[model samples]
Target: MTTCRLCGSSNLASVVDLGATPPCERFLTSEQLDEEEPSFPLHLRVCTSCWLAQIPPLITPEETFTEYAYFSSYSRSWVDHAKSFVDAAVDRLALGRDSFVVEVASNDGYLLKHVVQQGIRCLGIEPSRNVGEAARAEGVPTSTTFLSESSGSEVRDGHGPADLVVANNVYAHIPDIVGFTKGLRALVADDGWVSIEVQHLLTLINNVQYDTIYHEHFQYYTVESARNALDSGGLSLVDVELLDTHGGSIRLWARPREVTGEQSARMVDVLEKEKAAGLHELSGYADFSANVTRVRLDLLRFLVAMEEAGKSVVGYGAPGKGNTLLNHCGIRTDLLPYTVDRNPYKHGRFTPGTRIPVLPPERIAADRPDYVLVLPWNLKAEIMTQLSYVAEWGGKLVFPIPRLEIVEVNS
Candidate 1:
């Protein structure tokens, strides 16, 4: 993009060009395999002025989220994480049965179900019709629409202002950062808390998690940039918490500017940490592109050596991040014959660009593949426990990001 999506600055610098890949979630049906798949440039650029890392908004949110393939409830750890967050939020915010909660991009009611059980009134604003229906079926009051300023205002008007607004792993998904933030501000009460959990740019760069970069995530954020983004919507950053989810993420606690209190010590400490990492300057990103190349090379070498050794390597999850890693490393079915996912929607489909077949999780044990490459490595603990049965067949698990490592699972 010529200008930064958040700051409107014309100055932008390259972080890494992952070459071109299809929309990560655009899985293909057998009937459409003969048709040409569409691809777009997957380049990440940082706006020096605002220090916000972003990709060109080649695909709209509607195209990706309208009939989304990702169902959040598939991951047991994530569900447990959501439940923990709900419990903590209720306690921290002194929420009760009379309190109202709103969650943006609430997928399949994974989180709001906990809110429901607490006897609190809650609404989920999810864009995907399929997942939205699933949420409704589970008794979550959901409105299927993208969060814009208008929609957020309408929700607030219809249901009254939320006592707590929770947006998890979705702050970076929208191209219009300012408008989305405004929508978040619109949905929350003037004195209510807004809690957002997003992948921290500090962790993304330091850990070389380039695989998370896709057309769907238009921007990345450090606490500095996130604070600025929140300010644009009249929300002031109050507290911050470093989380282990999605490799590394930051949970930002914010409030309306008028009611915002002094910055929490935790927020101040995180900002200092970002400064120590040089995230506020261009130097922190200097080694990122080279590090990304190293990771791609390392993973490719492992896969190729496995192939030459006559060892079968299949993927564990067909997540969006996995598609980026596969497409970037130029891996086809020859290297990874197929991958399995718990999501039924992807069982018969092929991963975008890579075109590797997706099967059910049972196939891993049934086929007894020599190695199961764990694609969604962020949930390593949970996945390893579930696939510990692989040890029965002398199968090992492979993790690609943060570094390439193969582990022997104990039964």
Candidate 2:
């Protein structure tokens, strides 16, 4: 039985099934890929008890990100986001020179560079060796190992309890969600805080973002479900914020159970909303499969029409969601000429299953395709702004999910 990762409920309903897919980061060389790359089941199910959306068991952190291909320094907007986050956190927590901040899955020290610039002592725990090296290059101290109970113990011995621990878009990535949170308990100092930003389940359902379903993201979180997980790990949520980043996300602030303060009204507000929306009810997941079916049809129809029109469609950002959407919709090189990524690690490789070639963003500009499909719909605004020059040649940008629409940008 595929039990709920959070509540251990055995009742799980299969929602969206994206059949065997390669890990999103495993972009393969043309020669190696032609020899037949492996793919795994990409099925997602919502636990009836906790409403935690997750994929069927497959892959591990070591399998997904250890020799990771992604580097945060590639994205200009992301670097800005990281810098702003450091500023916001330092002020919000009244952190000073004496304070120490630790970031889990702190890819390439994107955020901590700014923390260090502010003269705040910071440490990054990154599992991916390549990205960890990049963080080290940026002068941000990093530990290149998975953050778990054992790793947390080692971290505590060296850095003591951390004043602030930041986990951005990482809560959903681990298979052992409980053990991961328990590690937080062992590492955080008294009066310390943990802030985790996860793609919201509410947004997933409403937007029909079934493409976000993949093995790397082992669990989808709702405010209520996350609170339950934290409670089990001996922590309390002191605040919660709705962030516009990552399509839609919830930033949760937590501290140890014994620590008490007036809980942020935002936290109570989100909890009440989740309850009212039936996130805590068993029946909430029943209709999600139907919604996913509709999304698949809508996307396939759009792609077929674009192909028939002889319009060259290219994809932007080789994100996990793009992989699911492409594999689920049966899109191949016939429909997509190639996809571009800003990350050099993804260059010179083909996307798994579909075998669409991954190229640098300049390829899109140089080719001047009629339509550039925005794959990472969450960052459509950021991408559109970056590629605004596409409009100079009268090219239009298209978004496939949640209905297809074309918007023009002034160069």
Candidate 3:
């Protein structure tokens, strides 16, 4: 029986099932691709007790993220987002040289660099050795270890409690979430703040972002669930921001429950919004499976029609989200041919389950495929701007989520 990760309730219900898929970010080499690949069932189970949407136990953290391929610095928009967050955090906290900052899952030092530039002491806690090495090379002091109570206490004891603890897009990657949160309390100062950014469950359902459901992502959070997780871990949410990054996300600020500060009005407002959207009710999630099936059929039809018309289709971005979409839809190289990404780590690697060869962005111009499927649909605007040349050849850019639609490129 699959019990809820948040509340330990066996009253878990499966809302969206993508069948079985390999680790979404496990891009394969030529040799690995030739060998048989392993896959696990991908299903989002909602906890009736707490409303946290989570994937049933499939793979461990070491299997999903230890030798991670995804890096934060590669995306210009993501770096900018991090910089903006750093700016806001510095200003909001009135942080200066005396303040210490730490970021968990700090891939490639993208955000901490901005913090360090402000003359504040910054440290990164990242599990991936390769990514930690890159962060350290860039002058960001990073520790390559999984965040737990012991590691968090070690960090606190070694460098003192952090004035600001940041965890962005990482809360979902953890398997033992309670331990992860308890570790946050250990790392944070009494008066310091804890900020987390998670892809909101409300946004995921309303946007039909089923592609975000993968092995690497364990739990999706609504405001209530987010609050529950924080409270359980000995923290309290004080403020919140609904952001548009990663399709849609929620940036939450938390502090130790003992802190006497009143909750921010915006946080209350967001909670009310979630309540109005029926996030606490099972009825809110009942239709997601149907929507997932609809998109799958719609995407299949689009791919089939394009292929029938002798159209050559290529993909942009070898993101884990793309892998989920591809593998779940049973799309293979025969349909996609090859995909392009700017990240060199994934350039020569094949996508996990489908085995689609990833090439450089230059391949789009060389091959001039009839259609370019924008796999990372959330970054469509940025990608479309970069691949504007595709329009010159009468090729249309395709966005696969929320419905597959051809986008207009500037002349």
- The numbered model that scores best in TM-score is 1
lDDT value for candidate 1?
0.94
Instruction: State which candidate, 1 or 2, has the greater lDDT.
Output: 1
Note each model's CA RMSD in angstroms.
0.8, 1.5, 1.0
Please estimate how well model 2 matches the true structure, expressed as its whole-model Cα lDDT.
0.84
Candidate 3 clashing pairs? none
Per residue, candidate 2 scores C-alpha lDDT tens digits across 331-374 of: 89888879999888888888877888999889988899988889
Candidate 2: Cα lDDT at 215? 74
Question: On residues 227-313, what C-alpha lDDT tens digit does candidate 3 reach at each position?
Answer: 999998899998889999989999999998889488889889988888887779888888889998888999899889989899899
Candidate 1 runs further than 4 Å off: none
Task: Give lDDT per model, in order.
Answer: 0.94, 0.84, 0.90
TM-score of each: 0.99, 0.96, 0.98
In angstroms, give how far residue 400 of model 1 lies from its true place: 1.1
Alpha-carbon deviation at 391 in model 1, angstroms: 0.9
After best superposition, candidate 3 residue 2: deviation in angstroms? 2.4
Q: Order the candidate numbers by lDDT, best to worst.
A: 1, 3, 2
403, model 3: CA deviation in Å?
Answer: 1.6
lDDT of 3 at 381: 72
